[model samples]
Target: MRPLVELVGAGYAYEDGPAVLSGVDFGIAEGRALVLLGRNGSGKTTLMRLLSGGLRPGSGALRLDGEVVAHDRAGLTRLRTAVQLVVQDPDDQLFAASVEQDVSFGPMNLGLPVAEVRERVESALSALDITALRDRPTHLLSYGQRKRAAIAGAVAMAPRVLILDEPTAGLDPDGQERLLDVLAGLRSAGTTVVMATHDVELAVRWADDAAVLTPSGIRTGPAGSLLADPELLSSAGLRQAWAPAVTSFLRTHGFLTANAPGPRTPDSLTTWR
Candidate 1:
């Protein structure tokens, strides 16, 4: 099958501004997750906008399922519908009085049937486990609740590829866990996910492929390999997951003769002791 999305030599810049992205290239396959890693102002957001068809590239081309996406309104609309973007700030996305209304907004705007819209709204709320908040006012909810509502809104559109900007930002431990679980569920259901995050731990824990935007260029590889390389980690402004740090600490303290292989998840760290 063709990749869900591909960027070939894609570059973008604001009007008369310096180039935010240059010579960018990557491909996201169906049913796989790609995490965008970079420091602030490294063009991650610009790249996400390009992929979602929100912003056309100034140079080069972006393809959706093998078709060039440029100067075609219908194709762009279809691509936007298929590739939904969840903004970093939920407040900017949620305008409806209630969570259900907000979630249904996208499908309703697309002229979906009333029953289908309701079903999508309910299904999205269920997926995020926020069914209880469906009737609550969006503004009244906590930050985490609002974030989940924003995600539910995107889910209601039933996008094949979900692009999330800072999905784990400003959340407590519980909220982070909840959001991560939601993302994992989406990936398991074959929804390709591309999330832009500065959180190395989240990327290492959740993403299969990681791409880092740097002054030199975009670096792409498996998350594990990238995290294990200290130079790459520093260059990308990323740190190893908790388990790896603990393993290294144990080795330094002579608790282990050699640094053991790091555990994949935090829960698995308990077995190390």
Candidate 2:
């Protein structure tokens, strides 16, 4: 499948500051999940901003569906509608007094009919399993609740691509699992999902492809192949993913055949025994 969006040699930096991202070349196919892995200050957020139209690339090109992205008001507006970004900080994204109003903001901005906007808002809230919090004030919600509300706002926009930065940063384990399920549902519904995170285990289990951002550039490929390499992980400031570590342990202890299929999820580990 052709990529829904792509960056070719894309580079960006703030005024007089050193380049945060340099020579980034990657593409995300429709309905797929891409995990961006890096330590803090590794340019994950900068790359997300470029992908979401929050900032134009200072060098190279960014394209959506084979066309170069335009920077004009109308062009950028269209880009925003097609690719919605949920930043790491929900506090920065959520401003409305109530959850329902906040989630409704994006669709309503599109000038859709009231009924359509309402339907979208309802669907988004239901998808995130946050309908009960619809009328609650944003200030009263827990951190995870506020995060879900922020995601709902992006979902209401119905973008082809959803970019999330450090999506699991503040969630408990249960909340993280719930958010993963929600992301899986969105993938099934044909929304391309791009997530930037420090969680190597999450990337191993969830990503169709993985990209590791470094100060010099990015290295990207199938998730399994990339996560299985300790050298690569070390260079990217990440450890080997959990599955590989477990598999290696089982192999050294003669608990499993060397030809066993690599397990991507913990549930699949039972196959080895």
Candidate 3:
């Protein structure tokens, strides 16, 4: 089956800078949570901009459902309807005074009817668990609340794919847990989520698939196996996730069987052993 979105032999470079990405092939499998991992300057954000229509690929093609994506006005409209990207900083995305108005902006701009727009706003607010803050001022919201508000704006678009750059960045542990729950709900509701993050633990715990950006190129595979590879992690300038370490220690000491599946979380130890 064709991926919902794909990049074929894609390459990108800034006006006068070296190519940040080259000969890349990426596919957004429908209904899967994918984590993009790399150190700073690995082009995760650049690649996301390409996926969301913010930046056109400098070479090769980006495709939606196998057809090459067009960047014209109508083309962009169609693309935006299918994909939405939330950046790292909430302050950069939030503008409307009230949370309701902020979350309503995207759907409203889509020219949805007031009732439909209201419904989407309510739904997104609920999905992010910020419905109570709907009437509150955006400026009055905490950093975590603002982040959810920004994500809620994207959620209100009802896109097929949502790409978030560091969704949990700047969030406290409780906030991260809450955001993870919100993400789980989104996936269960059938939205494909792609996130770029430095958190290997979160990748191991939450992602179904993962892509690691290295100087050589992008490596994509099952998060469980991919994150277990210490060499790959080191090459990508990422630390190995602790779950893999625990899995290794257990198996080496005969606490767990060698045939056991790679652990996804700390809780998996209990389940596996």
Candidate 4:
């Protein structure tokens, strides 16, 4: 599949700060769940900003649909319509008094017709399963609810690519599972999902592809096999995800075949012989 968004030899640096990311080449393919992983300050957020048109590259280029993205008003407006980014903290993104109001903000700003805005808001709320919370005060929402509400605002824009940063950070296991279900629904409906997370286990189970930021630059590969490498994980400041011990035991004990495929999620192990 071709990338909906791509970065070729991209680089960035904050005023006088040493370049945090340099010589990076990456892409987010259409309709795939891509997990972005790295140590603190690994440029995961920077790369995301570059993709979403939040930041212009200091060098190289970002392409959307195979064309270099323009940084002008019309160019950005077009880009914003197709790509949306949700920050990690819900509080940072949520400002309106009510969930419905907040969710409506993006489409409203896009100058969409009232009818279309209303339709998009309703569709987004339903997609995120937050319809019941529409009239609820944003301040009154729990962290998880606020998170969903923030994401709903982006979804209302009907983006082709959705970028989330540390989406599961504060959630408990159940919250994580629920969010996964919602993301699954989004993918099924044809939106490409890209997440930046530290949870290797979640990446193991959920990502179709992964891009890890290393000291040299960026590394991209199939999530299952790539994340399973301890050296690679360590180089990216990540600890082991799941357990190699259990997998090794299963294989040696003949409960799993040596060539058993990843992601090797629990369900994938249920029928191993």
Best by TM-score: 3
Kindly list the per-residue Cα lDDT of model 2 for residues 1-273, writing each as its tens digit: 767888889988899999887777878888778999987888888888888888999999888888899888887888888899999999999999999999999888889999999999998999899999999999999999999999999999999999999999989999999999999888888888999988998898889899997655688898887888888888888888789888777778987688886566678767745
What pairs collide in candidate 4? none
TM-score of 4: 0.93
Which candidate number has the best lDDT? 3
Evaluate candidate 2 by giving its C-alpha RMSD to the native, one decimal: 1.8
Model 3 residue pairs with clashes: none
Clashes of each: 0, 0, 0, 0
Backbone clashes in model 2, listed as residue pairs:
none
Cα-based lDDT for every prediction: 0.85, 0.88, 0.92, 0.90
Across residues 174-267, which tens digit of lDDT does each residue of candidate 1 receive? 8899888999898877788888888887877777888888788888888777655666667766666665576667777887766357556678
1-273 per-residue lDDT for model 4 (tens digits): 667888888889999899977877888889889999999988899989999999999999988898888999988998999999999999999999999999999999999899999999999999989999999999999999999999999999999999999999999889999999999999999999999999998897899999999887788899877887889899999987764546766667787777874335556556744
The TM-score that candidate 1 achieves is: 0.90
lDDT of 3 by residue, 178-263 (tens): 99999999999999999999999999889999999998889999998899899999999999999898878878888888787656
Q: Order of all candidates by TM-score, from best down to worst? A: 3, 2, 4, 1
CA RMSD for every model? 2.5, 1.8, 1.6, 2.0
Task: Tally clashes: model 4.
Answer: 0
Write the candidate numbers in order of decreasing lDDT.
Answer: 3, 4, 2, 1
lDDT score of residue 180 within candidate 2: 93
TM-score, every prediction:
0.90, 0.94, 0.95, 0.93
